[model samples]
Target: MAAVVIRDPLAFAAIYDRYVALVYSASLRVLADVHEAEDVTQDVFVRLWRRPETFIAERGRFLSWLMSVARNRSVDELRSRGRRHRREALNGDTSDDDPATLVPADTDDPVLAAQLHEAQKLVRAALVGLPADQRRALELAYFGGFTQQEISAALHEPLGTVKTRIRLGMQKLRRALENRV
Candidate 1:
């Protein structure tokens, strides 16, 4: 690996080729926005190229270390953007009834609107089925855009418990909705 870092150009290129997709996918999972994910993915590789000496094999496998960096960076980006979005919302600079503010108003076709409406109904039903605490946690985190720590403070629950509830609630919701669909 060190030889690849120092002596062989093709070996470094091979490493990038092997790991680029994994890094991009990890970024996409955290970001959920294609353009932002793509930008972050490129940045991750650029950082790796600039600081190949920073990666120590003793800490973990190369891909594992790379993935950890990618995931952390993506999450940090999301949290930063989320904070900015919440600040904007709190300032009341946004229009409440603007469809564009919530979701894109113009769909390319009617079928897309029907599919979106159906998905919304299924999600609503799933939320209604959750236990009150779990539902509240999910709502505050998802709709209100509160972080787990914020939700814990707001609901007077431990941060770990709030995170667990949200994770479990989402797992159950996914299963239930899968069966329905």
Candidate 2:
């Protein structure tokens, strides 16, 4: 499929369909923001499509390569925004803590599938526990990639209020996950 990707866009699209979710999830987990995650996902695929020749099967599996690229790019993004984040809040500096590390492609292990299912449920429950305003702000900031000012404008709230909501929301999330983490 990759060999034909340059000549056939459909092949590239198929690859996108196969890995987009995984890539996006990894990006989101690392960046913790929807907009940056999406950008990273798009950038990863674009790099693959634009430089198919750079990939050598002899070096490694295609999927692994894609994931490595995604991880590196995401970490780079995080590093670039160092001042914006509380560095200690992240799991670790290594890719070992990456959410994508928990996912393996083309697996048939029932136990692994169950674990993934349970993790999803836990995340959903955590989201549900958040206050409505905090949750909305978190969602908008994390998933929508909106700045604090932008979020305030969109929600028609004061800038300070929006910032407070996001802060309180993050603290709540950390407290909720403190034990498990």
Q: What residue pairs clash in candidate 2, if any at all?
A: 34-142
What TM-score does each of the candidates earn? 0.52, 0.50
Cα lDDT of model 2 overall?
0.72
Model 1 RMSD in Å is 10.0
User: How accurate locally, in lDDT, is each candidate?
Assistant: 0.69, 0.72
- In candidate 1, which residue pairs clash? none
Model 1 lDDT per residue over 1-181, tens place: 6756674678667667666766776576456566877988988887777778779999888867998888777767766785654433222222233344244423433554566557667877887889988987875554345688887876788999999999999898998898564
Error of 2 at 62 (Å): 0.7
C-alpha root-mean-square deviation, each candidate: 10.0, 12.1
Model 1 residue 125 CA deviation in Å? 24
Residue 25 deviation, candidate 2, in Å? Answer: 0.5
